[model samples]
Target: MAKKCLGVREDTGDPCKRPAGSRSDFCFAHRPQEGNEKILNLQHDPYHCPDDGQKLWYVPRLKLHRCGMCDGVLLNEKEIDPLVLESVLGLSKVAEEGLAVECPTCSTDSDLSDGKFALSNFAMEWGFAVQKSKYHSVYYCGVSNVGHCKVCGSTWFAGPGERDALGKNVGKERGFWRVQPGGSKIWGPLDMQQRLREERLRLVARKTEKRERMREKLCQHVDSNGERCNRRKTQKEGSEYCFKHRPK
Candidate 1:
């Protein structure tokens, strides 16, 4: 007697009555091969996807639980834990202060004062798929925050610090030398040019001083024109000219 295929449609849970393969319990349509059954279940899983109420699939090796219809990624148990802990422990309070920071993109300060709460919460979900079967499991994930810069409409992820989503330091004022004396203040363009000019003048003065010292050490030997030798004095004991210009 020919054997009936032991296969079921993951989406409708209907039995597949096609004849079994020569050496397999399942028909070619419901075979457990990697690309065949796996890819097929992704579009016809038994459980409905929470995102769109369509079929769902779980990939054990890859730890991926996704909706077949909408292709929405569902978080795993390990990934859901942090969100649950934060929500239950009221960690959203830390994100409230994040709105006080200045937007790094536009430099405009973000303020949540006018009933625009920055510490918003969202619902999430986790899903699990059976490795070789069409069964799926979904769990209520937790809450998350959708961060955005209020000033420029730029997206951001808030951290539990005094900095904004753009990583710019918060609550700090920017200006020119409200900067205390001796503190590291960046020089402005004109101020930098003035500094460069002063440095150049100082270097020129030092060079002029060096040249005067060299002139002061000139040889005292008289030349044929009755003029003192302009050569530097480098002789020992009693000589007056440099070694090459000395009276020889």
Candidate 2:
């Protein structure tokens, strides 16, 4: 076993003046102060002194403006880019609001990323439905009853749907589907399974259209209170639909 020595400065060609031996080559008179202890009086080197003058061996950088001298050891100057220095030293920065936020779910803040991964993290947390709604989901199941995959420019029946269920279960009657990376969830060549998803979309679209029309007409009754209290009631919150913001 190699015995751990006390504090010893590495052997350099400089002759030993104050000989101090610890773990390193310096003799007893020249060891650095104990751990974390401040050396009130530091030896300086005449080479770089009034800094490194006492007797401590430290190199001073005359080219770079930094002195790595410790306990009165000397430092040297080395040319470095100011921009690079500021960046590495946590000195340069942009305004606070300009930064993109990290995913609170993942406890990671990335200034470099444009939040695509963050949104993915959010979707993973809330539910897949949110992602389906936020972006168009393509469902491509080959159930002949609903018709065939219509996505052009590609060979496979791609899956794209507005909802997760529509994409996943579209041609389920024929066989199960597997979601692929190219913005599609694929369906099998079942007879009636594919059409089921299409039907659902159609029904939803129709329902939405009807609701929108109703709200458009109902919004005309809005009052000065920023609410359509009702066709008659003037008190805010007294009506089912506000004139400007009608409920579906």
TM-score, model 2 to reference? 0.19
Per-residue alpha-carbon lDDT of candidate 2 for residues 1-248, written as tens digits (9 for 90 to 100): 33232232333213334534536443454444333111211221122212222333321111111112222111111222333222222311223333323222122223354444321100000011212475665433221111111111101111222223223443222212111111122321222223444555565576678867766545355467876433432235645444445543
Q: In lDDT terms, how accurate is model 1?
A: 0.40
Q: Which stretches of candidate 1 lie over 4 Å from their true place?
A: 1-45, 78-248
Identify the runs in model 2 with alpha carbons over 4 angstroms from their true place: 1-154, 157-186, 213-217, 221-248
Q: Model 1 over residues 1-248: C-alpha lDDT tens digits? A: 77876565554334566888888767887776334554455444443332244444444433334443333333323523343334323322333553343222232133334534232322111111113345753111111232333334432222122332223332322211112111222222333334533554555566678878887688877778898777778758766678778767
Mind sharing the TM-score for model 1?
0.22
- TM-scores for the candidates: 0.22, 0.19
